[model samples]
Target: MDWGSIFSNAMASALGPDAIVYALAAIGLNVHFGYTGLLNFGQAGFMAVAAYGLAASVATWGLPFWVGIAIGFGAALLLALLLGVPTLRLRADYLAIATIASAEILRLVFGSVTLSDWFGGSNGRQQFANTFYDMNPYSSRLDFGLFSFSANDAWVFTVGWFLVALSCLAVWSLMRSPWGRVLKSIREDEDAVRSLGKNVFSYKMQALILGGMFGALAGFMLAIKQQSVIPTDYATDITFFAYTALLLGGAGRVLGPVIGAIIFWFLMTFLGGFFSSAASIDLIPDVVMSDIQASLVRFILVGAGLMALMIFRPQGIFGDRREIAIDGR
Candidate 1:
């Protein structure tokens, strides 16, 4: 196992487009679950809709990439409104249930055979990113000795990071204002905010829609990054991973999810490569572990780490304990 290669790849993964994608998604989630205490269990649903929205728009409707972007955001905003209006008035778990159910429903609907002509069904849609790649300024591949990326990936990384920065800056600015204070107040006690004559429901709707739009941006980046949109890629696991990023970085804080996404991807890829390499070449006897064992080891390690994080430091690396203690509804 080439340690240098493993380390370089791991670092590249941390700093590459994958990190940017997850960071964008996690940041949006921070707005939802972290600050607003929305318990939005279907973040991937928003991402899926946005991704497919872009792909379908361009592939079937002959729309421009920018139009697809708008469509994606519009779909996510609608999803947020649809999910929030019905469930936000209820307890936290109800929002969670509705979100998760809605996400799965969207996935199943997108995968339906009836929509295959347009959505490509289970195979998903592609060729929606040609216009995006056509905007690339760099004609040659980019390399920094330790790692390298194709011209296409570099363009994706550049745009993706830009979106992440914009989203973070937006969150930072908003969280410092009176409006942000209202959100925190609602998280602490909606009843208290209501008593103060604040329109709690409106605030909740705004939070949901904004967060969902952020998720939509992430989905847009993901769609262009991969140059494709597959329904399976936006599974519930993506939501779990994004949540891990939020928990790892700390919720409610502007920079938590970005830091969490980088670290989470780094450790995950690094440990996975390390353990897999060690298990190979008979470093570990088959009795103790086989090649197949290496595959499951990373998930177990990452899961245990997440468990430890929740148990010992629920507030995350950047979050104070108070940040995690939302209204106990």
Candidate 2:
């Protein structure tokens, strides 16, 4: 098994845009579920709204880059309100039901052939990122000991990492403020926070809108990173992946998603390479696995491992047990 290749691929995923993208999304989720205890199963819906906002703005309206960004964010905020208004005060399960349904509805709408003319329907959109790329600062390639990045990728990395840093800092600062305490309190017991005179519903709305916007921002980055926006790309599976990254690194911590994304992608890529190489050499018989089965097998293994982690070490690597423990009574 080419150990060097395995390491390189693992490192690439760990340090690359995939990791950063998930980290950004998970950070937003950390706000929704981690600190606020809001089970927003429709985070992907939020992202979709933002992605299409940018895509439609430029492709249909010939808008500038900043205008597209504002449209995306505005669209996310609108979705958050629409999702939260009817369900925020209903109860946890209601919020989940409403969000999940809303997410699917948005997906269906985007994929509907009726709006294909403006939204691009099943085909999606591209070639709408001239403005974002115009701001790239790096003029040449950047290299560091066995790793390097082309200038465009460097701009993405630079911008993505900066967003991650800013998001984390925002999370850290918010968690330290009075509003943050209220959010944590709501997570523990909304009734208790309500008794203390905090508008529990409003706080949750704020958290949802804020986190959903961050998810939308992540969607924007993802679309711009590839210069495309497709409905299927922001499916519920992506939301689950963001959740996986959040949990793997331990939720409720500012940097948990960042660490979780690194670890998740590293393990996923490295294990895939290792298993494929082992199969190529017949180290593992076809009875056990094959190269063709590697992709599915790695996820199965990770899922089992995560199941075990939840059973034994529920708080994750950097998480404090007190942080994740629920006293939902």
Question: Best candidate, lDDT-wise?
Answer: 1
Which residue pairs collide in model 1, if any?
A: none
Model 1 Cα shift for residue 300 (angstroms): 0.8
Candidate 1 stretches with Cα past 4 Å from truth are 321-329
Determine the backbone clash count of candidate 1. Answer: 0
Candidate 1, residue 263: Cα displacement in angstroms equals: 0.5
**Which portions of model 2 show Cα errors greater than 4 Å?**
286-288, 323-329
Consecutive 10-residue window with the lowest summed lDDT within model 1: 320-329
Whole-model Cα lDDT of every candidate shown, in order:
0.88, 0.87
Tell me the tens digit of each residue's lDDT in model 1 across 224-282.
88888888988888888999999999989899999999998898889878877888877
Q: How far is each candidate from the true structure, as Cα RMSD in Å?
A: 1.9, 1.8
